[model samples]
Target: MTPRTFSVVIADDHPVIQLAVKSTLSAAPDLHVCATCSSGKELSAALATHRPDLIVTDFTMGRSEGNDDGLRLMQRLRQSSPATPVVVFTMLTNGGLLTRIRETGVAAIVGKNEDPAVLRQICLDALAGHRQRLSPAIAGLMASAGARADGVASPLSPREIEVVRMFAAGSTVTAIAAYLHRSLATVATQKRSAMRKLNITSNADLVAYARDHGLA
Candidate 1:
């Protein structure tokens, strides 16, 4: 006898992550990618259309991020489909922010650092009533999240924060240096340091982070 098919809905802003997730889940005989959405608005619409058995989503989604994208969306999911299990598929490692994720009643949390195949196993486990599980790559993340449940604290120093805000707001590195009366080298270094602290190696990702943090 064939097992009951479980349709899955995936929501992420990145095409690569979406593709990876779709590919991973498609390998499972009983799992199906019923829909994929790139934004909260789209996810809401997909939920209405597909009414999927499981949802895999990200904390931030495109330009609408920092708009209470996490908590509010999770709240909506709970209200709209409380019985459907939700699995957070992300690469975010902010301990404090991850704590807030746990409060949202999601069924599971899987990091991008782990093989997407792990998500498949965790997805099956979540269906069996497990609340959450963490992979080895980010196992300590939740511990930190648990210890600092108060709230997310900024990792950037004040200078780094200033540098990041200016860069994100379209100020050129030279311009920011001139305006702040700092050497170009100093300003540039600060910008690079900030990016590193945020785990962003590319300018595009930095801009996305800025948008997600309301700095852009």
Candidate 2:
């Protein structure tokens, strides 16, 4: 069987990093960058209009005003399309952040400080169905002092689980509200409650918890 041609959407707040990703991915004949977004809101809007095979996103965007903007976008994406792979490339390499991102079920994690070629290759491998963890150093730290040792699965409610799954699939809050037929504020409240229950202080942390507990 022929492999499917993958369409990707790149989401990063940094112009330089966005350009770097675009330039690198452009070299691959079978991969196409269908959209580039600098904020979670922009990525959410693009995903509503286009269904890409994968999403390559930054963990944080200096340009975003909303809370945990990048992770929110990933959650929204996952909510809308669970099968679509999302790869996080960012500078937040601390064990705490890495643990949270893992929970979000991102296909791969690549540090910004790593070689651009290496990052690009990781993305490519993820598109081909491989689960690439963070760099050896990052992984070593996580294996040592991170949530893996905590052994506490997140204490998320079924509703929150539902919210997270939807978030991960790429459903916007508005979409989520509409789908659940609840008010926006109510949906937001429930999501927040879930985050609090899990002791997740940020979207990155939420992602890590979800990845760790297999909730995402």
Candidate 3:
């Protein structure tokens, strides 16, 4: 029996990085670069057309037009194809960014400055069904959040808890509506209610509260 060829799509704003990644992956006999995109919109369009097995993208792209480019792309991919593995190769190693990426269900996170061999290994591991890469900083953040038990518990209604959990899970208002079988306006209302109950003003705060409460 013959093994299936793995098709990959590369999305990054930098042409040089895109070329480098394309060159690196091109060396593997079992891997194929199906498409290359320079923006989140292009990436989404390519994915819709090509349906690649894996997607490698940077953490930010100017083409997202003032949004967390890679994160938005990941969310779109999740909505369109939940099983396609995504590997984020970026220089953004901040704990908050890492946590956000993890919540978006990216298969692996590799530093752009890391050895190419390490990046390749991570991609290979992801192709073989591994998920979650623990950088020391991300681990420390997770550990600290675990130790803090000051988040809301037992007082919020089940709907409120669901709203908070979905919010922490990186679902936008529309996504939450779809997930909960509610209208967009209803979901937004629930989100606001949840925030008011927790006295949080931003998604980051909501995520932190959820993390502290072990809701994520």
Candidate 4:
């Protein structure tokens, strides 16, 4: 019998990164690059059509048709393709962004600045249904995040913090609800509560807070 092959869909806005990732993955004997998409819209379409075993995508792909982008895109994949593992390949190093990404239950996260080999190995591991893996840097961040959680008595719940982080990263309320599986009212309530806790009266204030906290 022929060996089974794993298919991957790579999504990113940068053509150069897309090409590099494709070339790297194609070098693996059992891995195949089924499609490459430049936007979240294209990623969604590719998911529907190709149904690849795994997805390698940037954390932020500019908005495209279907309103899929960044956190929203990750949420859609979680809801629509629960079984397919997703690998976030991006340059974003924001702690808040990392927190929000973890909430979406991604399979692996490899920084774009790291060697391409790192991403390739993560891909191979994800294909095997192994537990989620975080690169050393990401693991360290999570460790510090935990310490922060323990030492700081933040007025906001982790969920609320995550929601604010996504909003700061450019997600709309509706998109947040869709991604987090919260009702519109629930999302709004959390947003309002987060703002109130931080004494933020406007979007500008919320954004500024996020930036100050390295969430943006």
For each candidate in the order shown, give its overall lDDT on alpha carbons: 0.75, 0.70, 0.71, 0.82
> Measured by TM-score, how close is model 2 to the native structure?
0.63
lDDT of 4: 0.82
Pairs that collide, model 4: none
- Residue by residue across 112-200, what tens digits does model 1's lDDT show? 88877799888878776775665655557756545243434467755676567567767789877876668999999999999888789
The C-alpha stretches of model 1 lying farther than 4 A from their native spots are: 63-68, 144-216
TM-score of each: 0.66, 0.63, 0.62, 0.75
Off by over 4 Å in 3: 64-68, 134-216
Ranking by TM-score: 4, 1, 2, 3
Candidate 3 lDDT over residue span 28-138, tens digit each: 778899999888778878888999888998866653232335455677777877999888887653343455566678887777776676767677778899756654433
Q: Choose the strongest candidate by TM-score.
A: 4
Indicate the residue-level lDDT of 157 in model 4.
Answer: 72
Clashing pairs in 3: none
Candidate 4 residues 14-103, lDDT tens each?
999999999999989899999999988888889999999999998776653474666778888999999999999877556555766766
Q: What is the Cα-based lDDT of residue 127 in candidate 1?
A: 70
Tell me how candidate 3 scores on lDDT.
Answer: 0.71
Alpha-carbon error at 27 in model 3, in Å? 2.2
